[model samples]
Target chain A: MSSTINLFMAAHHKECDELFAQAEQAVSEGDWEDGLFRWQAFADELEKHFTREEQILFPEFEQATGMTGGPTQMMRMEHEQMRSLVNEINKVGTARDMDQFLGLSESLMVTMQQHNMKEEQILYPMTDQSLTNAQEIIERMNQ
Target chain B: MNLHKLSLDTIPPILTPFRFFLSALLFGVLAALLLLYSREDFWFTRWSNSNLALTHLLTIGFMLMVMMGALYQFIPVMNGQLIPGSKKLAPVIHVLMILGVLALVSGFLFSNSELFQAALAALGTASGLFALSLLPLLISRLGNQLIVYLLRVLFLVLLITLGLGLFLLLGHALPELNLPYRFYTDLHVLWGLAGWVVLIIMAVSSQVTPMFYVISEFSPRYLKILSLLIILTLVVMSFYTVFISKQSGTDSAQPFIYYTLAFLLSAELLVFVFYTLLKIAQRKRKIADVTINFYRLSMFSLLAALMLWWVAVFLPLAHLTYLLAILLIYGLAISIINGMLHKIVSFLIFLHLQKLSLKRPEAMTLVPNMKQVISTRNSQIQFMLHLLSGSLLLISVHYPALTVLAAVFMLANFCWLSWCLFQAYLLYLESRKKILACPEISMSL
Candidate 1:
């Protein structure tokens, strides 16, 4: 199961999902202040999660597999798309354009769901199987 | 382990699924026209020529066609692998299925045993090729349990259902070779409606409902049980019908087994529907998109069918069979498919365009958002038309004249649906043309 690697990474997704729902709930109810606060927290957590994968897991995977222009490359490109989406979301400013926010937020959700599904279902298990010292890798990434 | 499965390449060109969607829409309209043509027989009898034809039109012609497309599109993303030969084999599979279903419809309409034989041969061959071509790819990606496992089971059951059905048609096809066990018909229907249809919908929705609607994962435990209960009921009923019927001849098989199976299946469906409604109610996003509206409508239709299914077991009410068929087949299954068609098509269009725009930066401005891909007004009209047809069809059971009106509404709904999807296609084409023209800033796709 690659308990450390898979669970640790997937838990971040669960955490981000919770915050995302909270922000969405707030916005749907037209609570801008709370919505912004929760949304910011979600964005920050999401960035951290993305960084963890991009820097640590994907590199370790690429090194082990030596398949540079494959799944990981696609993941990086999708990350770029998501990051650009997050950037646009951040620019919504103080005047709450709830419709646009929700629209883009929906996009972010789909992007994240697809990205996370591939990572959890495909990449993590593969990494778990191939890596000689996953715990050490996890420890290094944790640091 | 084929890492290529996880990449965008696994996602076939848009036409793969769009063709299926467009065909399903056309078939839906065809079903409507058939309904209008056979308005008298359609309302009068469930097993009559026109009624049987209409059911096939909706079931095999429309629903299965669309499902084949969606399965191809989603298998990769869902399992992190592409179905082998998905691109090349699709057209062949599509033609066979369309021809097979049309033959079945004609066989029923004309009471022609020859057409029945033709349908069995065509459909069996098509489904056999379908399984051989695609199931292996999906099976190899069994990275997780429960949902994936259920999907695998459903695929097998689907093949069995087709085989059993073909077996039944054989006696009629060739009067020279007689096969025993007349009750295989009930077994085939049990597997098709309960096992295959119910399980696949539950399995797909477990992932999709949460992903598309931004709802949390709602019903894993219950969904797993619901799927299992449906299968268990199917197996139990099959045993009671086939094996037990042999034990004491025709008299041994009682209505009680049928009664118990119906109750068990209907109860599980009730839980599933309620759980779905709960999630939709608790959904965080409340913008009221057409897809969301479709989801709500689908759940309610399922709920209505489930309730009526329960009642139909106790009292054999007139038109009860037709009512349940409409509710289950058209109301629940078709509505969900129609709802997903919008999301899958729109998302796929946006995805390819996004990928294209990334490569050819000059075409960035030409790229469309999800909304622009299909106008809200168009989908709203489609949904309303869908609701209108469903209502009129429900009423047509009592008044046969309204069957024509119901068919009109259903046909109109599908026409709008086809138009909406075509618009998305044109938008995609426009993006492609503009992107291809600008060769200056080309990145390899």
Candidate 2:
């Protein structure tokens, strides 16, 4: 019953959160290998999340609501912001600049969480309310 | 459908909250100076003029100012609904609050009826205007989220607190107006402190703790039930104050009801504080965070205050209530806000700068990271100062002779906080200038 976009997307958010937190924890404990592993995992999952929303969900939301330049656009902009932050984080991680990496991680964590909050709280619910094919969209997201 | 209102893009111009925050720092400084000027004698009684002035300065001037500002920013973000006409009205409300708090503080200090009258007018108008601005959002089609529900109740209690305050002020401004002064005063303090302030803190903490620290989320159902119970207890206590306690002396069995309510409140808060502490201690990403330090301090202070509250109920001591106030207000409430201020101010600056970077890719390099906006070193130093000052003030309750020393630390604490904020603001301005000077380049999202 809760297989709607809201539940699907929100579960993905929590997964990303856990992965990101594990990476940060590993880094804090000086486990560079595990840290980078977890960090890459988190980044990959996050990028996939963005792709799912930007590719499948947002377009459906825009077309269904006929509001192409609305919340979806803002979400798109925030996604780009997070992407940029993530790229910086990758650089810091590669350099093994622990302090800088941690700092950027904090920044990314906040940016990513707030972004996820908007998507989960506002966008996903709106998508569920407005779309008739939410299950299908979620299925596509899974694929 | 005005879906734009629900869009997360609607950040109030950053100055909306910053003005109130910087103003709060000024009040904190003023409170410190007032403590220095009044010396240890202000500790003798809660009813003393200077003590009342100091209390108002902290509660209304510092705490309420910051809380109101935070609300203006957070309500929109959380509920995804904009306050109507926030751009213009927010500044006006900020100015009115400044005037109102100053007038009220001066009225208390100088025993000036005219200042009390001025305070009444300014504060009443400001509260009314603020409540009006929020009315649309509160009544609108907000989701049945715990935060929205809590804010709705918090706002109602705030209005009641203000109404009681206004009546009390009227009694001061016009001595001939027969008012149940003691009764109303107790009720006002209870509603203001326990109802409005504590409730808002609980609501904000539930949201903030898990999100910021990457801890497990609080059970929303449990929190909602707890909030409702707190409100219900307050309602019952108010009725007791009105009917039962007013007619009887301390020896009456009705006083047991008072004790019971206090015990309930203390137990509830104990649960909140312990849970929060455990969450913080168990945070997965254990890093050297100044905010965590502040949170720990505030939680411990809350625990101490709760313990002392129980002791006060058992043994009627002169200094216990005063100690409880210090622990609650300065130690707990101010500590949390101070911690939040560091994180929030940095986050806000970083957010706005991020938007600028979006407009121009050349500016992307210019945006400072969150920690760079307020360096960890500076924030940690400020936290230490705050802890030292709060501890000294608590000690000054027993040894009034230490008031000057305590005031000195308090002054230093607030001044340091102001300087930290000013430093961040300067960094922001510097970054903005460098970014703006760079060639504008189109960036696609």
Candidate 3:
């Protein structure tokens, strides 16, 4: 059960990284149109991933453990931070200020990767261990 | 799978400090406008005493106030650990900052007066103290490299800029001070804008962009290195140019270096935009919230503003350059701030409401959605007003009446935003009261 959750999260992380790289390439080449498209795609993936965690995984965890606030709240806050950056990037993108855009992207990338690492290595593994009905949860999530 | 619930009471008191900062920002904006109006007589007079007043109001008063408030609220959330001094030191810093800004602005306005010189020294001391207060939290959280680096750089730049400004003030008071006023003045502005404001914004945004959208994470190493490199390059180039231009007695090389720096900065900004858009695009969430819409609009505007800047830099039209600056500063910067303000206010309110709900779920009835906390209608109207004012102000360079109209609209829009923020605050308090009245519920395990 734990392995499945780990695998799913790992795959998602990899996909996200790949998308980020593509966006970087587009930016470096000054392909605003394609860059915008790819970047939006990356943001979408993240939204979906977070939604699954918040709605499906988090609720189940809360029900099982009766602890509701800490992890979920932290995750939500991180989500807020990411959204703010996206908004900033969007603003900079509209201005077409390449230097500001690149600088912001570089900083954002680092913060996000670290956030993912904590979730992947610590939180997700802990969840997998605590939830005995993990297989069922994974199947439901997949479905 | 029960997660351990962290008590709301245990969370550090960030809201009180933020309120003080917000109040400071309000005053700062008003001060800036008043200073600008006073300088109407000699609008193009660079390095004038009145201009100094306006600059300080904008930078120290408005920008720093907001930045400090945000850091107070966000740092703990980011690190998953609360700052020890947050509850105690925030108020102290806030008082110092406000008094410092007042003193500094007064000093700049009365550059030649002995009393004003003393005031300036006091303001500098207050700011130094405020910076010192933040050192502990900053040092403890050195793990967040982007923020840490930005804070360090901002501190250094603040010292340089403020020191240069003081020198200029002394030079005004005592002509024998023998200061190279113009050189230091230019360097001061450059450092304040690029080093302090831009760097901090970059650092905060990196964490925020992904967090807001629940997007995949960014590459941390790349971000930290890029930010450091940009700052280093800008600092080196600014100093080199300042000294070289003075020595060589030529303005020819100035434009080249400025343009090169601008191009590099633009490239960096573009990368950020692209990366954020990519993350948002990949998000699985189907719901289109107000925050998301504002975020999208801001991103689009950033790109448009950048293009305009590029054109303005290359083109020979003075009016165009002025217009582009307005668009970039007021249009892009304000829009992003407005959007983020909406979300931040709403989220904070929501969190407070949820905390109350824990004690009394019934009291949660009045808790508003993110949209209700900030009226979308008001925001839309304000955004349009901002756009119109920006356009008019640009044209105002030729037609004086348009400038007055621009100022009027801008002020009105800002009032509307302030009202919305106040409304959110009231709602938050009401919700808190309801929670306090209700009986706490025991956890069901």
The model with the greatest lDDT is: 2
Ranking by DockQ: 2, 1, 3
CAPRI category for model 1: acceptable
- Candidates' TM-scores? 0.90, 0.96, 0.70
**Candidate-wise lDDT, in order:** 0.77, 0.84, 0.62
The residue ranges of model 1 lying beyond 4 angstroms of the native Cα positions read: A21-39, A88-103, A132-143, B1-9, B138-142, B175-183, B218-224, B245-253, B439-445
Give the per-residue lDDT of model 2 (tens digit) for B1-445.
3565576787888898899999999999999999998897878789988888888889889998998888887776666766776789999999999999999999988899899999999999999999999887677665436666777888888888889999999998887787667668988988887787777778887777777887777778767877788788888888887877666744255767778887897787888788778878877656668889888888899899888777777787768878878888898889999999998998889988888878787678789888888888888898989999998998888888999999999999999989988888888888888888877766553
Q: Write the per-residue lDDT of candidate 3 for residues A15-56, one digit (tens) a residue.
A: 776676677568757888898788889878877777878778
Which pairs of residues clash in candidate 2, taking residues 3 or more apart in a chain or in different chains?
none
Residue B322's lDDT within candidate 1 is: 78
Candidate 1: pairs in clash: none
User: What tens-digit string does per-residue lDDT give for candidate 1 at B256-316?
Assistant: 7767676877777777788778887766555567888887888888888777766766677
Which candidate has the top score in TM-score?
2
What's every prediction's RMSD, in angstroms? 3.1, 1.8, 10.5
Off by over 4 Å in 3: A1-143, B1-10, B28-42, B110-119, B140-176, B253-315, B319-325, B442-445
* Better lDDT candidate (1, 2): 2
